[model samples]
Target: MDLASYAELAIELVNSSDPAEDSLRDLDSLQRLLRIRPHLGGRVTRRDLDAMRELRDSLRAVFTAAARGDHADAVDRLNTLLIQHPVQPQLSGHDGQCWHLHLTESGSVPDRYAAGAAMGLAVLISDRGVDRLGVCAAEGCGNVFFDTTVDRSRRHCSPQCAGRSNGIP
Candidate 1:
């Protein structure tokens, strides 16, 4: 996925309540997890999609730390990543794409994607609060999620994830 789309998806994937479910099985699952709000006719790939999964795992760490209300740990993790894989934003796409910056080079692996997403979340937490990260309260599923809700009371990634985790019949 493109950088913008990756950013959008990062928000949703980190906030999803069911990381182990079918929603995460498709190529677009990464986009969905990051909440990219896919467009029709968009091409997706799973052959080289390992980066997306890596993104998921890395995000899981951040969300898990956030869920526990440990801002220090989350920040430290993100910072370590930044130090290890520093990136500078530059414009390269021919489409102009608003001339936005990217945290990693083109064709980056999942690690780059994960680092970028974590960096974004870290910024959000530093500016907003650690309460933005959350987890499903359902019985079996302990998936991590991002709370973009204005009220900050979101409890699950989706109704289905919530119901399944809660043992609702």
Candidate 2:
């Protein structure tokens, strides 16, 4: 399974807005985020947006711990999250596509997202190793990312950040 892709959901949630700078502190931004990640179905509410933000922080911590070479801490945090939001895996398919694994069948918006994120991150660390988790090395950009490069030397979270760090205008 391509758990690495699912694991990147954590990165997406963290990099939604700059943590050390800007933040998506409104319902509209939350809605827009959900639009991009359609797997997190169900109605969203203000409380849910709050919960998601908190969950985002927790997920970020996981990456931070992993990047620091503290895999135990990352695993511990992910374990608690997984227990809190258990994945109810089921096969799903539509639009002439073959069935693929789905995380949760039913839950609140945050629960569904947390469940999938937790499980995906778990699988990711297990299969790929904790070294795959990373934090950007760009100045003023404390973003989280998965190091999927063949040589695993990805220093910045994005090409834009790479250019900025490399003194590109």
Candidate 3:
């Protein structure tokens, strides 16, 4: 799978929760989450859901460390994660069509999530820069997002946050 996709998942997972409530609060939420994230799809169990939540927390720590300009700290945290949930990349294709790279899909939910998310962050840091990761700049909101924009002008996680912060409403 594309490492960029994994990076995207890391950001989305970190931002999934707000002060209002935990978004991954039930199996239905997990199903919805998987529906959007086809790569993270499979027969997820209650244990898998719990593991996914743990992975989300771990990714949050990684993003938080990166956003604070502590690249070394972020790398260290990521190293620990990489150690725990190592990614096994392999080439795969369907019906002898186009071959593509994919990480090992066989593992616990947290293991798979961690492997992909870690590899994605590593790729982002190596190919782009540690500065590519960020937490939202909007006051009172701490959502995380990966900065893929060329000019790196992103600050708020979305335009809604930007509007609220700038008092556009």
For model 3, which pairs clash?
1-101, 1-102
lDDT of each prediction vs. the true structure? 0.60, 0.82, 0.81
Residue-by-residue lDDT tens digits, candidate 3, 1-169: 5776677777777887875766689878877776876666778789888888888888888888888889898889888988988888878786676888777567866677778888888888889888888889998899998888999888888899989888988
Task: Report clash pairs, candidate 2.
Answer: none
Per-residue C-alpha lDDT of model 1 across residues 65-106, encoded as one tens digit per residue: 778888788667667656655555555554655556566554
Model 2 agreement with the true structure over 1-169: per-residue lDDT tens digits: 3455677677778887675444458877777777877777568888998899899989989989988999899889989999998888888885677888877778898888888788888887888788888999999888888887889898889899999999996
The local lDDT score (0 to 100) that residue 10 gets in candidate 2 is 73
Cand. 1 Cα-lDDT? 0.60
Q: Poorest 10 consecutive residues of model 3 by lDDT?
A: 103-112
**TM-score for predicted model 1 compared with the true structure:** 0.62
Off by over 4 Å in 1: 1-58, 106-108, 163-169
Candidate 2 similarity to native, TM-score: 0.91
Query: Residue 78 error for model 2, in Å?
Result: 1.0
